[model samples]
Target: MNDKTQDIAIVGGGLAGASLALLLSHHLPQLKITLIESFPLFNSDNEKSLPSYDDRSSALSLGSCRILQTLTIWSQLKPYLTAIEKVHVSDRGHPAGTLLDYRELDDISDEEALGYVVENRHLGQVLLSALAQQSNIDTISPATVAEVTPQADEAQLVIRQGDKQQRLAANLIVIADGAHSSLREKLGIAVEKSDYGQVAVIANITSSGYHDGVAYERFTDSGPMALLPLGDFNDEHRSALVWTVDSDREADVVAMSDEAFLQTIQQRFGNRLGFFTRVGKRHIYPLALYKAKEQIRRHIVLMGNAAHAMHPVAGQGFNLALRDCSALVDTLCDATVRGQSPGELDVLNHYLSRQDLDQEKTIGTSHLLTLLFSTAETLPAFARNTGLFGLNFLPGIKAWFARQAMGVAGNRSQIAQPASSTAAEKRIK
Candidate 1:
């Protein structure tokens, strides 16, 4: 174990990388951190116009919300959050809809929400602003990692910053670049990829009736669709929509007039939220599952989409990434206290080991759900409707689904537990 100051460099300052930097900065104040991002940081002024942020909304599991609170950014995000108190899951044209209510959970408090919905841009604004204020973190944005050289004792990153090229040495290098991480490719890490041949079209819609803080998951003939409750827009109830369309039909769906798009959505989603009166800008992304065959190497590790990217069917992608951040922070803090290099293969391995089960559960659950709900086969359709009906009537099964959806199942990490700040302090001490 070395007590000397260690340089930790994180590539990719998107949500995953940025959040990890913030976590390390908070828990291990003595470590010098550098966050490199190719895209310019989002700010209050330009967030509205940012292409990357275009109408995208993220559902924060209770576990993720707890982690954000420990980072002290929850307050800043609260204003933009809309609580998801209930989830209604059903198959399109089906008679029975399954309900997962926060109030139904014996352990969940009546006042607490099952989860929350926030615009990605808003979350990024909070994270980037907080990172800028941290004295220990050096954020280099609008820059790229041209090369990475992992040495016996440390890793060196060749960074291209504007007109200048500079080198940075770090004891640990974290690749959070994204699903299609160039750095991962530079490091020659192979990935297992599965394309679902579906595209997720995202937008916000104002409905005629109040959402009542309910989130809807409807499996239709087209694909899986979700309507997450959102704060009102101009006094009209709003919901963020994630509609999955076949890749072959994505172009036509996106090119449709607003009215036509709304009509199609209403037809697929039904009238649960009343008519969708107004629609916002729509953005589309191809659905895929990508898992880094290797998550840990000598002095490196991958986070977020860099490590694994799952279909958005269950909205577990970012939540699982946040859990990774917490586990990494815990492992690093322990390594630092024990005088061990955080970048050591053993240390990196320990962190990945802790995440294996979580990753498998989340990835498998989302993937299976997508396959089950995306089909229109008579047998699959009958099973889908039967499953929903059974889940609604079976308390144990419904509770299990609810817990997984809220990210409170399995080994609850310290960051996702009650008194997270106190637990974090304990871990550091």
Candidate 2:
């Protein structure tokens, strides 16, 4: 077996792993990084070959957009994005509803939308393309990590590619294999999980009326549903639909005829965007919240879905992960200046310390929203509707809620700052 040494090794090449690799390469060009994946990487032509780059869409919060913008590839992703100008939230049977407009935000200008939505495939393409252009990053795909052994100084990885094997040593190892992480299990890391007893049915839909860049979040007795605006395809006014339902209804919902599915969703979602005209392919996945017991070890770090997976009722999952990435980058950059090893426990702990509060707040809010909106209990129902109604009258509270949704409510990371203000940008040139 051949042996190699690198400054860092990433276990997964999915969205989180790819984004981390790019951030590291951009900010710390002197460090040698290796990215490992079980699936083939850079096969953009065959979208099905890559599981992460599916037909689903991701809502990029304003803060997440700023993070991507700092990477200098947002322009490449711009054409594929659909801006969300307003957010209309309401309860199915209640007369109370609130409209969150982008113009109402104090920090955001009229030229900027509250957030943007882009197809996952397009996002994957841009990230991969940027990774290909980095000179300091090495990608090893169509392979897997069979074992990881941490030593006194660094972590060793046993890699497998078909019949051949290789040994790799790195100062730091980032695990981003997904929510169901096999690598995390091998390391004896435990996770706390809460099953919501629900599943989300996702599909792209067309409506008779244009969406006008308005995203809708409507809560029903059954569950919460969201319709996020999408860029038109083939001249059809389109939106992405995420409808949560009881787990027992999964098979029936996926098996429904297109017309039946459209009618059912129309009845639940109302006529905000006119009648539901077309329903595309449907996909279903069970809903659960999972958080790793430990995010950091002596020479390891768990990232993205591997560390925390929350309910999507509030659309905060990916945005939170991106913020974690930004914080990690900042911490590592500081370590390099101090002439410290990235694998030091103190360094890893500092990274976690910076993110612990954000993670706790984001995860707690998502769980609360899922529970508060997924039931018809008299007390909870009245409280939620009253809160929604009050948002219309309370500008301070409503703005705070909007900032939370935009992923900019709390302290912003320095790495997510604009190119001119970020100290890391100086290293790039």
Candidate 3:
């Protein structure tokens, strides 16, 4: 075997790739690893895709926070996170008793908080910065995989990188590319696609009233509209909005003037936060549920959006990816210690099964919730408020849902602790 095919090669270094790199770097410090980014840079730092600036934010479960914290990566992005003291879930245009407060769940249990909302820029910076200093990890920019072919033992990757083209071999191939992955398709892995027929509109807005760390999710006939808490910007409390709209209205929303648009937001949003004075850059993604028929192909393994593109309704895409990375990290580390191949069936299946179970359940529930809430005429009046009603009245059920949102629902790892409780405590103080 050639020297190029010794360790592992990771393609597409986004959230999934970066997290895996950090985990592997921490657990198997001596193992040689190379990460290749096909893009020259990411959108937040530079103009790559979408916009000049990405104002969209992500809802991070407390569970994910602890994973990063354990990896020594949390401190890097901690300054940019906006704590969520409570999450108010309700039907659109609902009144006081209609909402579900996360604090109520804690009264029946030990911890508090549903999750935290953080800007994508903050997370991108932390993952990027951590990768920059790792001596054992090689980061290659502006590289494209021209071809890949697996032999009896070694897998060859022909990469055409700016002004240079070369073939590299590795024991295992990892694909962390985005939702529509060319790498997975290259191996002829078939995926089932289910369009949600709605678009998730994302933008950062300056909320008129004080947020006080309250995140809100109001479900409408169109879809769930969530205003997640973020750090105050320019004396205004910033809240990132995810408004899922019918596919037909997506274009109009994207083209709306900032002032007129804020007015529209004010109408649909009502006066909970008083007003949404302004909106930063915006993005709209056509929501879909895409999952591969299989997770592995000989020497290759797919992770992140590539493995399964989930609906943003529940905000578990990245969380699931983090889970996948954790499992892969454990599998690879154990393999190295036990003198096994990183791409072996035994190790890969451990990672696959862990991800598949969560992936299936999350995609199933989120898709159903999306369909249920988005259908205005499909529900009986009382059925409309079932979940919210349960959240407001049911103690055991509410805390469980809150913990589920926090990514601490069923953590197998002791280090997989959540930060929402601590953040909630600080908010109370």
Model 1: per-residue Cα lDDT over 87-117, one tens digit each: 9998887786888877666655544578999
Q: Rate the local accuracy (lDDT) of all candidates.
A: 0.85, 0.88, 0.73
Candidate 2 runs further than 4 Å off? 45-47, 418-429
Ranked by TM-score, the better of candidates 1 and 3 is 1
Per-candidate TM equals: 0.94, 0.96, 0.90
Task: Please give, for residues 294-313, the per-residue lDDT of candidate 2 as tens digits.
Answer: 99999999999999998878
The TM-score between candidate 3 and the true structure equals: 0.90
Name the top TM-score candidate.
2
The residue-level lDDT of candidate 3 at 304 comes to: 85
Q: What C-alpha lDDT, on a 0 to 100 scale, does residue 94 get in candidate 3?
A: 51
- Which is the leading candidate under lDDT? 2
Q: Least lDDT summed over 10 consecutive residues: which range in candidate 3?
A: 420-429
Q: lDDT for model 2, on a 0 to 1 scale?
A: 0.88
> How displaced is residue 401 in candidate 2, in Å?
1.2
In terms of lDDT, the poorest run of 10 residues in model 2 is 420-429
